[model samples]
Target: MTKSENTLIRLEAALERILAGEPKRIPKNRKLSIRAVEEEANLGNGSCHYYSEFSSKVRILKSKQRSSSSQQEADTGFTDFLKSKAANEKRIKEKYRSENVELKKTIQQLAAEHHLFNELIRRLKTQSKQLEVENKELNVALENTRDELTQLKRERIFKLNKK
Candidate 1:
């Protein structure tokens, strides 16, 4: 129809294309500004200010974009929270696994030490029994020798008295 109307249509189309490509590369909650739309449309400076309809259309588009972007930001924030939570859980599980492995090694080492100590105790008990037997035999021999000495002293006294 008119030249200005044709230019406005081009601006709208450019804005639509920019928004369409937003999910791939754009940051969260980003709305197109008048300057940005104008640049995409290849329009000269202050062209939007010159157009009364341009201002209203840009306002409506910005409002609609803002509402949708708010929802998108909320969804992205929730997704980020979930990812962080999962990562934290994974770290905790790994730490517990590492601690469990260390505990198992400690238990195994203690078991080995216990076995060694038990064998040492058994050997000591056997040695103690052998020593006890030897001590009893020595005590019996000493008693027999003491009795023989007493008998010899008695005989010596009796011969002296007779003389």
Candidate 2:
């Protein structure tokens, strides 16, 4: 009938969506906070604070939701609760087990790459040392060639002067 009424209805719907794990505007894993409700309802931030009554109602709903699962279990029976809990734990255990296997594969791949790189480095170092030795021997040969050329020039000059 009024703007306030419309906003309140929207907020209530958003809270229901969140509680039912079917939120539209906000993420499913978002906690039951005023801000989350506001976002879920597509309202501005702190909109809930504008209505004190609505804010209090939201708080109450949050507290109830926290213990709702246990309350449901109590209403039903311990057997059902235990079965559900065991199933949940089994799922979690399997998730972690698969993750561990993937991590071990990644580590093995990395180790193999490291070993290959180390071998490459060793071969490169050996080639580098061999090149250095060859370079030094070439330099010595160059110096010897220069000395012989200088002697030959001096002898030619002495013969020309005598002529």
Best by lDDT: 2
Encode model 2's per-residue lDDT on 1-163: one tens digit a residue: 9999999999989988998999998889877989999999999988889889989988987788768966886878887878899999999999999999999999999999999999999999999999999999999998998899999999999999999
Itemize residue pairs with steric clashes in candidate 1: none
Candidate 1 whole-model C-alpha lDDT, 0 to 1: 0.82
Candidate 1 lDDT over residue span 46-103, tens digit each: 7787777777888887888788888899899999999999999999999999999999
Candidate 2's C-alpha runs over 4 A off are 1-85, 154-163
lDDT of 1 at 89: 99
Reference-based TM-score of each model: 0.56, 0.45
